[model samples]
Target: MVPKGDLAAVLASLLPAPGSGGLVGADALRCARALGVDGVAVSVTVGSGLNELLWSTPGVSTQLEDLQFTLGEGPGPEVAASGTAVSVPDLVREPVDRWPVLLPEALALGIRAVFCLPLLAGSACLGTMTLQRARPGPLEEMPLADAWIVTHALTAALVQDAGQWAAFAAAEDGSDFYRAAVHQATGMISVQAGVSLAEALIRLRAHAFRHGRPLNEVAEDVVARRVHFRHDDGDGRAPLAGGGTEGP
Candidate 1:
């Protein structure tokens, strides 16, 4: 619960009265500062395995979500499964070995602390809110509580509008392109790679990371008939000469 004294300010920052750009607008980014955190991020994972980033407070938050999706491991997607919040006051000391690829990159990004809050609406787990910091230390009690409040408010906001979530999911904005393209590419790769859609998505992520490209960009190439994956173990994806889907 948010302290009453701070509640109004928090609401003003996150659920700003209309015309202030609303929650999906630039004004909402101020919520992180109001809560005393460096950055905040929001991601929605629909039942169909489609994940979209709703809000990324620029800089670190934006990059962090991208890496998490591309690497396919991190607190963002995992928290929804556990139905609980996960907090890391100090990543350097904790060394989240589970996220081997992410650890080094996160450390390089000057991320010393992180807290992930799961956003749940009714029986459905809507998404997650990720709070980040550049310094090492646990989030102070009040700030953590406020983040939870923000998450709850966000879920309610989305549920209240209802139509917006569908529009948000369908629209290209709000990181929808990446999730949609990844889902589409996964299905295509499944048949060509002789693997399941799950495996194909993973393979796509691996290929993108190895080639040092954005996952979404790689997905676009795959969807554009410019790339094809083989059942072969190495270099799962290869360029398709003449834009051919079938190769000799």
Candidate 2:
């Protein structure tokens, strides 16, 4: 069951329905603060090696979320790999090797602590809810539980709401029609590169990140037959037409 908190009400009251350039990340940060975190961010998987920032509290949290996406290592992936909450009371005090790239950078951001809670769909871990604090210390047991509740409720709102259940649940076009081009791009690349769906997404995201572009923009290109993954290494080097796929 989803966490029973005032978040559902808040989401209903504040979030823009479906994809009006609303809900998702903005609401995610709002709900996280309601649960008493200094900052909150949501990371959702679009494919292997691919996840997007669904929402984040303004300021440092948002920057950190972007950092995680760009660096490819952090509590985001740790929680996904471990399938459990990652509580770092004080990043400065922890071993430096633990988060080599992310740690040094996060310290520069004045983030003393973090907690990453998993967002699950049955047995599959879909994403994570990451909260941060300026002061170093572990999250109290009670708020930790609250964080879990919020994670469940938030994932429900982002993924299961309104009968939309594709990988991302919305289209980039913001139209009345739903288009899972991102999801299609993932699968299309999977077959094109002969890799698992997850690995395929990772490749796509890498290309987007290297070029300093958004994943959806890259996905749109793939869907339009402008890009294709011809080799199995997951490189976006394949150039062929009419190899795109669409979602149901």
Candidate 3:
């Protein structure tokens, strides 16, 4: 169990420093681990992208999270949309058909239970803090309390990073790092395949989903002229010729 005073100390220590930004990613995971929970992830929505700040477990991958975003469905989206805590204490035993695609994917990755808490300050939502356990069970009260503490810590960090927030928000809506490449690739694919940009984006996502690769990595390949999206067989796929996909 997490002591209230320890939680307070953790929050207080997180408030002021050059290390604050880095601390935001590790603190919750450490707290969860210390309190004997399985894993923790911190995610924030900036513009149209939900960037995962930190992930503490190997079972849930960035690929899985991208699947949620590309498909525009999942517990993360639901929590972000509703600004409410969503807990699925048992993913394997839950109604299988509810999230058709996500449930099976999560279960395949060995995630048995999940908890999400919205990161909010007043009426504004930053994102969500998600906790996952390998075994199916509910999060005890102390961990939940610590999760709330982590949320408030994130809020405080956001308040401190107001200037950075403005800069990030003012940047082009979908132009961050590899996102711009993805958009450009989407446009190119749309023109090539005789489809709309929306369809092109879906196709791009489908390729990434099918191949189990991150969309950003695939987009980088498309941008650098290393690969091309094709629909020769009525399915969109990128077949690379020479070079391997690399980070930007």
Best by lDDT: 1
lDDT of 2 by residue, 162-214 (tens): 54444224543543221256668888888876778766767776766556555
In order, candidate lDDTs are 0.73, 0.70, 0.66
Candidate 3 residue 217 Cα shift, in angstroms, is 3.3
Q: What lDDT tens digits, residue by residue, belong to model 1 across residues 1-248? A: 65454446556555434433233543445777867778888888764444677777877888788788887678886787776888888888875676888888888879988899888887678898999989889889888777888889888876786555465445635423435777788888888777777778778877777776667777778888677775555544443211113223
lDDT of 3 by residue, 87-184 (tens): 89898777977688888878877778888888898977778777777788898887788788777777777677665555455653421332556778
Q: Which pairs of residues collide in candidate 3?
A: none
TM-scores of the candidates are 0.73, 0.63, 0.72
- The C-alpha stretches of model 2 lying farther than 4 A from their native spots are 1-29, 162-172, 175-248
On TM-score, the stronger of 1 and 3 is 1
What lDDT, from 0 to 1, does candidate 3 have? 0.66
Q: Best candidate, TM-score-wise?
A: 1
* Steric overlap count per candidate: 0, 4, 0
